[model samples]
Target: MINRKILARVAGVGAAATVAMGLFSTGAANADTFVPLPGGEIVKTLSDGTVVTVRLVGESANINPSLGSTPVHRNAWVSGSAQVELSGTGADSGGRIFPGYTVGCQVNIAGGGTSGGVDGGVAWEDGSPSIGASGGGDLSLGPGQAQSFYILDLEQADDFGSETHKKRNVFSGSNGSVTWADSTIGLSGCGGYAQARAFVSVEVETESVVTWITLYGQPFSIG
Candidate 1:
């Protein structure tokens, strides 16, 4: 004796509302998607049958927008550490067969109505036990557009030498961290999506033998 038509209409409305809520929740979760980057590793053998392995691990980034700026600027603080290990006969040779190694990091920015890039790295001399860092970048603004690039910070250890050599040559073990911060700004008529990337490199050297390897992380977005 009930109104069958009215009951069916109410049920359909309830089902539609449930589906709408589910779609909204999915969109919200996707907005917060931040994927963790994968690390890369490489291994090389010296002339004397010495095996050297380099790895880039614990890589991450933090992106932020500048405050109170007419043309908004985006900055990223990228952090990670490089590890070097020697095995086989030359593993324990220290400065005898293995001189030392160099570790470095660089950030590349492209798109978002801007163009430019920056990079930096450090060298460790086992014989001198010395450490040095070098960095540089380039940037130019487009018509009716304003952009800027900067290498904000770099941090590394300075313990690659001993009393005698003051800067010991390369050794077999871990060499702390090589971190850097870079930024890019876009203003006025500049309004588009920009992309950024982080990369690491390692170099191994001896008196007569030398080799180099590099790895890059997945690219991220900055708007």
Candidate 2:
């Protein structure tokens, strides 16, 4: 017969059984404990087969220079063609955002992109056929501030492009207070085409917020 005392020690319950027996005794076998490995980040795969990677690209204050007065604000954004490939058995909807994945984006402007009179009244707004030109007020950078935000719609097509190629206007996860600058900033026209061909738009989306800070003085306001 197997030694009961040796089994208890190997089983890791020898001490418990020893107290009951008044002498060293083997303990019953206990289930092995399982420990999970660390370091695997969970990523959501969307229905459109798009993978949403969450990360901080930049901050609003770092991107926008116009917010030097009240708060240092900036916008985080992502732009480029998207890549889609079929791995398993799944249907293609032409234009559909895969569920589980999220595309969050934000964008701010330089001093030149601000409102009228404040920054010489010159406004740098981008416009596209689908989403159109977005104004500074959308970001609520305040009177002298200006910024924009964006994200992939994944579902609807706002810009003019091949449905088979996945053409859609980017949307903002933020409220009406935040929005994209315009298609004109990067895209050529309302037409989402590159080199006059069906270009594949594979790009990543970004998101950000405004960080409040103090602004400096001007030549007139100081002296």
Which candidate number would show the highest TM-score if scored against the true structure?
A: 1
Against the true structure, what is each candidate's TM-score?
A: 0.44, 0.21
Q: For residue 173, what is the lDDT in candidate 1?
A: 35
TM-score of 2: 0.21
The numbered model that scores best in lDDT is 1
Query: Residue-pair clashes per candidate, as listed?
Result: 19, 25
lDDT for 112 (candidate 1): 13
Report the CA-based lDDT of candidate 2 relative to the real structure: 0.18
lDDT of 1 by residue, 99-182 (tens): 111211122221111121222222212211122322222222232322222222223355764333221123333232233222
